[model samples]
Target: MATTPDDSSGQSTIDESASQVEILDADALADEPLPEDEAEPVDAVRPPGPSARQPAPLLPAMRPSSRPARSGDLLGYYLAEVRRYPLLDPEEEKELAIQYQDTGDPEAAQRLVTSNLRLVVKLAYQYHRQWANVLDLIQEGNVGLVEALSRYDPYRGIRFSSYAQYWIRAMILRFLMDNYRMVRLGSTRHGRKLFFQLQKERDHLIKQGIHPSTLALSKALNVPEQEVINVDQHLSAPAMSLDAPTSASGEGRPLNEVVGNDKAVNPEQDVARNELGEVFRAQLKTFETTLRDERERTIWHERLTASEPVSLTSLGKRYGVSKERIRQVEARMKRRLRDHLTRELGDEIPIYLEAPSD
Candidate 1:
């Protein structure tokens, strides 16, 4: 049976299946990552090999260029560029996804991603008020798109765009939270909730001629009064240069020195950290024993765990493949490492909020 892109009525112009992935409304975003796991120490261990400099992130840069003066102009340029890729119908999407899954075909994956670039832009628009430059949000969203490609399961019967939207939104939200203030906000889920809502709720109260106090906002939002005060203080606090002196006195110490100058080290914490490092290294060695393929084993040793990782492009040449293919392989290995750790450690694995970079 030949499938039509149109709905059952055959009257709808939009492909309902593709349209399903297109809906990423404000209410659908999640407040935070999973609950804290016991593996907090495990999370601290950088899974990939140590390097002089952090291996470049799998994602694109937060700010690509300083050239774009106004966000609107840059957006207009992107809108035009994204429009060049036509939307993929359901059949086309399924075909591409299945092909990519079977062979790790970069072309298939690229099509799936390019077709949905506009959707990423649409999702990024929802956070326009959160950040001044929409381009930055879109940049993060692109990371999510590539990430989604790495994890997307075509046979699961989920629409690609629908699944990709979650990644898109998550990347954007994380970017917003990270850059929200000079001192990063608390990692608590409640803090994330307050970060998004506290200001809006306060604005509503002010508009209604009611002063938004810690108590009133707490009662209205049903969060703790202290959390409300803490969030409000952070929001209201002005950014200051740490290089500046702590006080107006001419011979005063720098704020950084005065604020966090404690040189005391906790012996227990140091011991526990050392123990966790040993366990992490042990697990990596154990995983290495499980790799059967020559390429997989080489990548594991030379790139993933090497003190200085080989570049993906260089690895690609060694394997007679593209850097993108090398990346896909590296990502798969990391996923396996994560899975191996999860099975061995269960929920005890520490949860670090940031994406892992080797």
Candidate 2:
């Protein structure tokens, strides 16, 4: 019978068969050939070396793999292969982080980021349902992972996984917030909380048979009532393209055509106004011909009708008249012109041509 030693008890037991065992030289033992049935194929075995026992390096960064496959198949392959990268233990993680932090070594940083990529994928999976493309979320999370590695302090006594999770989730949420809709959902702290939690809280209230009013939601979620209403509307309303048909029949006009733009100038009204302006200018020219006094005509044409009307004092100096006298003459001329135009155009005279009431 064969016997074994007890390590814990510090005792050994021996059998007579143990004395017949043969010792072999290390080189001879390694060189010995195995039977055909027990031997590995020559092509399947690698030469013995220190590197043969080492693990393959993880990817330097998250990028599209160079494999010649469809994108979906490639992504699936990447996810499967990334999982095979061995996770770094606390000591290994700390050493790499410290090396990168102290010396700013790219190799150390690469190792630190690549080893923790599995963590980013795990976190990305949690947000997969909220986003359209899982790869986009994973890419965003990888960015967060790199950022976390840069800021990680090995002496903080917290695990790198714990620290990295916050950054990963933040980046994923930011991406979701930015791309989810054309209009942004939340811009304030309370608004952000309400945006992410309002649906869940509302569902809970509905399950309990309580009305999820704006006020009730505001109190439960600690957001303003108006903000709750605004975000709720945003979530409930799907974005509609302006080019989409406005009616159910699909033969109707596009929304962009149906919706009125108040700021747009009406073409018909613009043309009519332009024509009226021309007619008024003709009437003013006819009225200026009726002004028997050259001085009055000069005052009306140069001072009143000029694009930028001359100042009353300046007009008074140019015509060698007292300022008060110039003012009186300007008023009389404006009144006479208004009367003449009203008689000529009747109701068609533009309101702008009417005399200013003193």
Mark the regions of model 1 whose C-alpha exceeds 4 Å error after superposition. Answer: 1-72, 186-190, 196-213, 216-358
Off by over 4 Å in 2: 1-64, 70-72, 182-193, 196-210, 218-358
- Evaluated at residue 18, the lDDT of candidate 1 is 26
lDDT of 2 by residue, 1-358 (tens): 0112243121233232322222111122223342334211111111223232222222322433445433434344444445444567889988877887787777677666666666666555555445534556666777666656655677755566666655565566666655543224445666446545666577668868999898998998877788787666654311111333323244333332222111222332332223223344445556777886877876765555543446777768887888788778877887777678665533211122212111
Q: How far is candidate 1 from the true structure (C-alpha RMSD, Å)?
A: 23.8
Predicted structure 1, TM vs. truth: 0.41
Residue 64 CA displacement from its true place in model 2, Å: 4.5
- Which one is best on lDDT? 1
TM-score of each: 0.41, 0.42
Clashes of 1: 5
